[model samples]
Target: MKHSEFDEEFDVIVIGVGAAGAAAALSAHERGASVLVVEKCPPKCAGGNTRVSGSGWFINSSPERAAVFLRALNGSRTVAEDVVQTWASETAKNSDWLADLGATARPTGAYHTEAEFSEVDGADCYAGMNTINGEMGQFLLYEFLVGALAERGIEIRFETRAQELTVVDGTVRGVRVEGPTGEATLGARGGVVLATGGFAANPEMVQDYLPLDEYVLWGSPHSTGDGHRMAQRVGADMWHMGNMMTITGIDVGDTTGLFLALWAGHDYMFIAPDGRRFTDETKGNRHGHVQRNGAEELFPLRPFHIVFDEKLRAAGPLSPTSAVLPVGWKLLMENFVWSTDNSVEVANGQIRRADTLRELAAAIGVDPDTLERSVHDYNAACDVGRDDHFGRDPETLAPVSEGPFYSLRVVPLLGWSDGGPRRDGHSRVLDTRGEVIEGLYAAGEASATYSWTKDGGFHIADALAFGRVSGAHAASRVAS
Candidate 1:
């Protein structure tokens, strides 16, 4: 713990250049603290989950109402009352805080305005506060934060990965980092903040903690539990390790996954491995959870195929066609645009097509009769103008009868995991015994306060709120 050999030093050291880390760095700098940010990914892949997110930031107009809604959303899984209170109160200041930073807000339609749990008590308190000129699944917010950091001359070490926290007698002293040049120890005079995000891209963590056997990742590839491991190594308590934000998407290879635009129209259906229609595919899927058997639960974990006809294929792009931002990681990172007609996917074998329904079933490795029966039932429901089984909207009951039928394989898309080092309301990392680890802090998805379900903009909201808290505290702390 007494590593006197330090290569560099800063008043505050922030890990991961995402929303939380950027906020922490900026807040620290505002307090006249010399801050350095370490990012695991290169400049091109840097920003963490914030860069790839839908860019929907929010502020709570009423903290009391937000508290009620957050409690309802959390249900049985709850944190300390003080922590929840701070979460609501601080989140309420997000709009004002962003405004102070010279960021302007704009409406982003229903997806950003509406609360994920509309039926919850404080749903009315949810107010969308997207950045001006921002769109769903864009880097405008991240860019804004980065630009602010540059304006302040904050030093950021890209491709530098934090390996471990150097603890000197129960207090974090510095960080041992491995960078492109090699490994070195960097001393933090005030504290270190871990905003390294969640472990969505880590397969082992996913298998051990999450219930999904296989799924496409819709989050940053750099989110491999770096902060989780470092925090745990320093005796940090982990909470909500099993909770996640899940959705459904199609894997188009090369790390490209597309979220189907179910809201676009209903000329297609999701057929499970059993060649049967399971849940209402058109229902508003709340982070992949649905009200089933009187409790919210995840959608069935199984491989699925989007069965559609030539009409839907020719309608337009299968994914969102009008998103100002790229909807998927590969598209955003690699600049791989999805074909307008979806013909490129079919030619690339990402989508299976056949002239006959039986041929389509065979191509997708499902029993022909079962697939045909499932499609027949769906078409019959369309004919009768009602979906008795899944209760899909009667207005979206367009039959998928025109040949040649197409099937695109898809799996659950994990947005992010909200589990890592437990942090107090002030965003200080807490030990296993609920004691603060001095000179150590955490924010964002890695140390999210939400125990169970999270709302639309809660992740970014938490990051900004707690990031500022940690930054201000770290900057004001007495340097040893």
Candidate 2:
């Protein structure tokens, strides 16, 4: 908590190990620079939300389709033309970088614009998943890259906190770190790359940025805005403060699966607190849906409901990549912390698997007549090839008509911090004036204002590309 003075030197000092951190460390080290990774949390959980995400980063977005996505989501303000063009060109370069490393990145042939696991391509852009080896937001990669760095004798200090940046003159200097015994100053002789994650999970940060009263987090405990706070203390210019996360259907009051089931086959028809349908879910892509100002509609951020029968129940919950029967009962039970069976029960709040239509509707809190009418309309449409209400994926509409219906709650979760310090093509952090902050280089999520179409949907290739850029440029400035 207190700060004195000490100094440690390296070619680069990386603060986090999520996807960008992994790529940054590996790329920085590969170019023959001494690097040190400083982590403030458990090694297994160091990757943050990157571990739980779908892991595919968007690269080489088909321009026509990517443009469509940008327009549809009203995100023309979030990403600029030069940014997109620059990122698109570097797509394959990052792919090459990943392959040369010990990691595997297979083109998934699908572009994801939604939280759901499936991929879709439209006039807006090429969106889909890129398969990675680990679940920690490219967790397998952190394992590979971090281990590789250790092998090269790149020292990493765990349980180490970087509380201050040692800046001298207008140019950058090193940082002050606090460890178990005493404080030490770790200097980045060449450059200091701050990939220290974001503050999405921090209450004050979330409230300051997101403006949410009831909060549920999907990211790691370490993402308490260490990056934003540290940068802010030094008069760093911050932008896009009005933006909050574009989440799926997350139950603000519940905890389980860390809010991932928003699209995980829990398909529940969402209604506002007043209970009415909003949005045509099947009509547009997922990114488009998440970006919608649901508050402008009736629900003011409605929650989702999945009406199913014994058939779908037996069929099970779904995973996008895997073909196993999907974890049905497991999805149900695992929702509640105290449930002995781990199956979601009515007593556990919104999860309902009932024997009759009216009973299920009553338990779910919608007017029985409305639910029945909606179901009848849905079933009729299902028979005649229409969704009339929300236009859900036809393949998913199996008719909640079967006796003993079920409902599971789902919501959009803030997967990771998508907003950070703006950076140039070379990963240099820029102030609000668009001038480069000398000696302050950022990459990965820390410097993440870039060629993106929607929320949390950046291509993994971009992370690698920028990581390489930041490191390559940093290596040049360091003494040989």
lDDT of each: 0.83, 0.56
List candidate 2 stretches off by more than 4 Å.
1-5, 57-75, 78-86, 108-138, 211-215, 240-268, 281-302, 318-350, 356-358, 387-398, 450-459
> Candidate 2 — worst ten consecutive residues by lDDT sum?
321-330
- Using lDDT as the measure, which candidate wins? 1
Q: What tens-digit string does per-residue lDDT give for candidate 1 at 1-480?
A: 323667887889999999899999999999989999999888988998898887666758899998898888899998877778888898888767777888776667645677778788889998764654545666888888898889889988999999999887788978999999999999887899999999988889989898888787777887899999999998999898888877777776644466765544579998888888887777666765777656788663556888999998988877664354454576676665777888998898888999999999889898999999999999999999999998888988999999999999878778888878888877889898999999999999888887887777888888988898998889989443
Which residue segments of model 1 deviate by more than 4 Å? Answer: 1-5, 321-325
Tens-digit per-residue lDDT, 134-250, candidate 2: 222324445666676666777667788888777777655677777776788877766777777766667787666654555455545567778777776655766544344434444
Residue 420 C-alpha lDDT in model 1: 82
Report per-prediction Cα RMSD to one decimal. 2.3, 5.7
Whole-model alpha-carbon lDDT for candidate 1: 0.83
